[model samples]
Structure formats: C-alpha cells, structure tokens
Target: MISSRGRKIFVAIAGAAVTIVALLCIFPFWMVVIGSLTPENEIYVRGYSLWPQTFSTEAYKLAFEDPGKILRSYLVTVGITGAGTAVSLFIVSMCGYVLQRPDFKSRNFFTMFVFFTVLFNGGLVPWYILMTNYLHLKDNYLALILPMMVNVFYLIIMKNFMRSIPGALIESAKIDGAGEFYIFLRIVLPLAKPALASIGMFIALNYWNDWRNGMLFMQDETMYPLQYYLYRLLSSLDFLKSAAASTIDLGDQVFPSESFKLAMTVVATGPIILLYPFVQKYFVKGITIGAVKG
Candidate 1:
C-alpha cells in the first residue's frame, strides 16, 4: 500500500494537470466573451483582452439588425438539430442493437463495410454530385439533415455499449416470448441511456455546427442555419461595415470586424452552453462505458 506522502504527491500533480487543462479549454472561450463585449476600438488597439477597459454592445446590435434573418436561421438550426439528432440516434441505436446480437449472420461483413467507410471515402466531388444529382437533396431541409443523420463512428460506439449488455437478459426476455423489437425497445434502450445521451449530444453538435450544406445547397436566406448566417456575416466585411453604419453613428461607433468575429463565436456558442448542463450528467458514464471494448 502507498503511504500518505505518496498519495498527497499524486493528488497535487493530478490537480495541477487538471487545472492547466481546464484553463487551456476555458481561456479561449473567455476571450471570445470578453472580446465580444469589448468596444471595437479597444480590440483594434489592444488585441483581444481578458478584461476590457471599455465594454460595448454595438456588435450585438449589428448582429441582430437583421432580426428576421437571425430568427429564421435560429429556427432552421433548431429544427435541423432536433430532427437530425432524433433520427440519427434512433437509426444508430437500432443498428447497434441488431449488430450486437450473437444470432445475427452477415454482421461481420456489414460491420467491416461500415468501418471501411470510416477509413476511406469517395472523393468530395463524387459525394457532392451524388447528393445533388442522384439524390436531389438540394434546396431542401433534407440537404442538411440527411448528410449528418447517420454516423459510422457513433454507430460503432452504440454497438460496443450494447454488446456489453448481459446476454442473460436477452435469453430471459426470449424465454418470456418477447419479440426482438419489444426486447430492444423495452430492455436494451433503457440500459443504453448513457451511450445514447453521449452519441446524441455528438449528433446534435454536428447538426448545429454544420455550415457546409447551407453554403453548398441553400441559396435561400430563409434556409440559412445559424452557423452559415454567421459565416456569411464574417466573410463579407462590407456587410459588417454597412451593418455598423446603420446601427451606430460611424464617428462615435467603430465597425468591429475583429470584435464581430468574436461576437459571432459568442452567439453561436450560447445554445450549446445552455443545453450542456441538461446533458452534463450523462457525459462521464456515457463516455466511460462507450470507451470500454466488448
């Protein structure tokens, strides 16, 4: 057994390591918040500040000057995130449950096929042409949702977690004459909550952050997701400049290109922060269980 001195040293080292990592993770976000709140002039002169001398809301005002656009983007993003996550989770969980069954034939072949996609992929040109030409997913919500709805990595995570479920539970359910679907819905799902939550969060984040589909397929401002809207705002300096001209008097208010970028980061990140606490409870157990191999 280790003595008290050794234990204390271990604790101290671990605490320092964690503290450093936590700061590294948190400092960038803190800067984004501070920079968003900082006056444009302050950011220009001083670069990003941990603490600002002067605070301003002009950036936010400019962001929301197009309230209709922002609101529509918010709705689109929320719809995609909600629907995509639900459908993805259901598909992933079903595939996972089926693959974990010992009685299943062709499981190995399918699993390897799924895993192969993870390692190699058809080129971007083919993928783009296939989605746009063959599938005709463009100019629609399906364009956004379909691409992200089923993920191989997430499927594998769910499969591993389901594989760890006791075989006796399945046998007992069978003995009681429960169908596979009934047993899956009733028995497996409840036991797989942690894994589901973990993978569900990943899927949600993907849909939320996805701007490529919007940029690629969506010509309609009405269909712009929040991330894509924010992307457009950042890339077009003239838009930000003009937005500033309309909102704040040009002489008094500086147009915040630098600060606007940070403000966009702040706005884009707010929902994730608000939603995280709800799922934070599942993270540790879900990540741990999913990490363990069957």
Candidate 2:
C-alpha cells in the first residue's frame, strides 16, 4: 500500500543505516591492522589512528622470528580445522537425517538424550581425567578433532532443517529400491546444502578458534594449533616481564608488546576471514530456516 517514492526513500535510508553498521563493525578491525603497522613508539605517543604516521614491521618480524615453527603451527591448525569440519558436518548431518526419519522408533528418547548433555556436563576435572587418563589423547591430533566433532546445538539445527525435506520423496526413493544411505547421500544432502554450509561454517570456526583442547590435551610443541601457539607466546611475554623486570629491560619500545598483540590477531584471523564470503549466502538462508523450525 506504500507509495513508490516512500518505498524508495525507505530503502535508501535502510541501505545507509546498514552501511554505517557494517563500518562500525569493521572499524575496530581496521584500527587493529593500523595499530599493528604503527611503530611501538608512535602508538605510545599518538594512540591508534585510521592511518599511522610511521610504519614498522617489528611486530610481525618478532612473531615470525622462527618461521619454521610458525609454519608448522599453521599447518597443524589448518589440518585440524579441515579434518574436524568435514567429520563434524558428516556426523551431524547423518544424525540429523536419522533423527528426522518419520519411521524411526525411539527418536524422541535419543533426541532428549542428546539435548540433556547440553544442559549439564561433568565438571572440568572429570573431563580432563577422561581425556588424558582414559583416552590417552595426549599429544595426539585426534585429541583436537574428536572432542569437538559433534555439537548438540548444531545437531538440533540440522535436524530441524532436515525435517523440512518432503517425507514423500524419501518414501518414493525407498519404493524405487534406493537405500537409505543412497537417498541421504544423493537426495537429502543435496537438498540440505544451505543447512550443511551453515553448520559447517560454525564447526570450522569452533575448530579454528579452539585453544583449550590444545592447552589441555596437547603437550608436544609440534602438535600445537595456531591459537595455542600464539597463547604460549603471550604467556611467555607476561612471564618474562614479571620474572625479569630488574635484570632485563624488556620495555614496550624494545619488544613492541602492544603492536605484537595486534599483529597476532591479524595473523590468526586472516585465513578464517577469507573463508566467510564463500559460505555467506548459504549461511544466511540456513540459519534463518533452521532456527525457526522447532
């Protein structure tokens, strides 16, 4: 019922508002990048700016001092993220498909069983003891992948989305002698692309950002993910400053501590940021549809 001019004006205003919000979200990241490039002395004197008066690569140089070690850590993280996301997506989608099957008996019981874990968990001590003492995942890559391979929340979202799939299609496939697995792999999966993309992104981000598993279950420096590797670097910096305050002059200008922190953020986040655009369309569609279903 709105006039054409009103609609145009409304859309223009909405577009402008959205652009402002996007810039607001991006501004902090821009500042961090600028801060990383700005010299330690310049930052101390002039604070953060949209553009730096002087630039330095000292922070990046310090971080990559041991290029071999940094590269190894990156490989480990990339491997973990890739493997974990794929495994998680498969397991989650399979479980979702099975749970949403109309003929499956005791589906509600199994669903509740999965849901219960989300509400409560055995405390950290039990979890650590189970991982290290029982599973013997110490210093193992499975330590990184297994624990996070399935999330109950993702399971729920995927199940809800799969429920929207026409049951008649599954029934017809079965009548045509197509097995459940075939139908799932060929038909259901293709139809659930949006949900798969959405949940896959979440799983990838979880594995990418995870540091606790590395901290707790991994002891070998060679196996440490990029996040834990960066965490170790920061921890060492803190320890050095505290323990060697008098004997060592590890001042801000010497170490470029502030800029070093910003540089680490830039390095750790760069690859994952590149991944967002690929899945963004599917992600938006999937989350909205999945969230509203049950």
Candidate 3:
C-alpha cells in the first residue's frame, strides 16, 4: 500500500541498519584474520589495518612447526570439556528433576540453599587455600573439572523448566513400578533434551575457555591449557625472551610474536565457531522453553 518512493526509503534504512550491525559484529574477527596473515614488521610499524599489507604464512608455520605444545593443550582442553560437561550435566539434571517434583518435601529448602551460594561465595583467598592445602587439587586437571561442576543459575533454570512438565507423568511412571532414578533417567531426561542441550553448551564453553584455574593451580608448563599457555606467551616478556633466546642459533628464523598471537586466537576460537550452528537451535529452544514456562 506504500508509495514506491516510501517503500524504497524504508528498504534502504532497514538494509543500512542490518549492514551496520553485521559489520560491527564481524569487523573484529576480520581484523584478527587479517592480522594473523600480516607480516610482523608491518604490524609493528603500521599497527592493525583492515587488510594485510604484506601477506605471509610465517605465523601459521611457526604455530604448526612445534605443534606439540599446542596439540597437547588442545587435547587437555577437549578432555576437560568433554568429561566436565558429561558429569556436570548428569548431576544438574538429576538434582533439578528431584527439586522440580512438587511432592518433594525438602525442595524449597534445597532451592534456597543453592540460591544462597549464588549471592554469597566463599572469598577467593579462602577458596584458593582450601583447594591448595586441604583438597590438594593444585597442578591437577581435576582442579578444572570439579570446581565448576555445578552452576546454580543453570540448575535453577533447569529445575524451573522441569516443573513445567506434568506431575501426572511422574506419578504414572511411579505407578508402573519405576524407581526414582529410573523415572528420572528414562522418562524425565528424554523429555528434557532442549534444556540439556542449552546447559551443555554453556558448560562446554566454560570448560573450554577456562584459564584462571589453570593459572592459579597449574605451575607445570605441561599442565597448561590452551588459553593459559597463550596467556603466558603473550604476557610474559621472560617467556618470549626464553623462546627467542632458545632459537637464536637458527639465525633469522625467529618466532613471529604478534602474528603468532593472532594465529593462537584463531586456533582457540575456531572450534566454538564451527560448533555454534549445530548447537544454536538447541540453545534457542531451551531458552524459549524455560522463559515461557517460568
């Protein structure tokens, strides 16, 4: 019903807005990619540019040349993420299912207990001392996995979602001679796929990106995860000095620090980027279900 001129104007404004937002989201990634390809000297002299002035594979080559460290870090991250996600999901889903049951006498008390921890955390110093002295998880991979096993926010969201399911369904399963665990695993979990998927991705991202635990607990170079390793490489002048010092005999084959950092960023981010599309549907579905119900 609009005039041709008005329709054109509306289309132009909408297209311009979309283009601006898209560019804002995409420009940093584009810069990182271009920076990775750029020569170190050019980057150092000229600063970051929208396009690489002089392209080179030296950064990627350096990253892969002694890929042993990077590969080991990747394996550690993958293992932690996989194992942590599985264990945490199991625990969260089970706890949430129980808490959601209307007849569970202690459900209100238990929910308040969890909600209390969200607002009041044991401070960092005491927690650190406990892990190091009593728990003795220092320099251990379990330090990464065990500490983050349950997120209260995720638990609450899941419990609320589970509440939306009919109580008659649980009663019917119980009448069929199903035990609590059996009903939870066989009946509840199958119906809670959307919530599980969303929480799973959240847990996976947490485990994958975790470096604070690694930095605090891990002293051994071999125990370092990818992010912590990259952190040390980027932040420590002594570490870079030692690396460059060790390679001094190679003469003109020095590590490209700037470019290599960009390459590492790409490596660290690549898997999650690839994984987003597959898990995104579940994420949206889970949020919608939880939000609408609670």
Model 1 weakest 10-residue run by lDDT: 239-248
TM-score of each: 0.83, 0.82, 0.90
Off by over 4 Å in 3: 1-11, 238-250, 289-294
Clashing residue pairs in candidate 1 (N, C-alpha, C atoms within 3 angstroms): none
Model 2 C-alpha lDDT per residue in residues 153-188, reported as the tens digit of each score? 889888888888999999999999998899999999
Clashing pairs in 2: none
lDDT of 1 by residue, 1-294 (tens): 578889999999999999999999989888889889998887778888789998898778777765566677889999999999999999889998898788999788889988898889997899999988998877889999998887887888888888889999999999999998999999999998878888888788889999999998888777888899888877888754543436445565455688777776677778889878887877666567666542
Q: Report the CA-based lDDT of candidate 2 relative to the real structure.
A: 0.83
Error of 3 at 38 (Å): 1.4
lDDT by residue for model 3 over 1-294, one digit each (tens)? Answer: 569989999999999999999999989999998998999889888987998777987777766656777777788889999999999999999999899787899999999998898889889999999999999998899998888899988898889878877889989999999999999998899998878888888888889889999999999888888788778877985664443324334457445788877877787788878888898887787667657444
Clashes in candidate 3: how many?
Answer: 0
Model 3, residue 35: what's the lDDT? 93
On the 0 to 100 scale, the lDDT of residue 180 in model 1 is 89
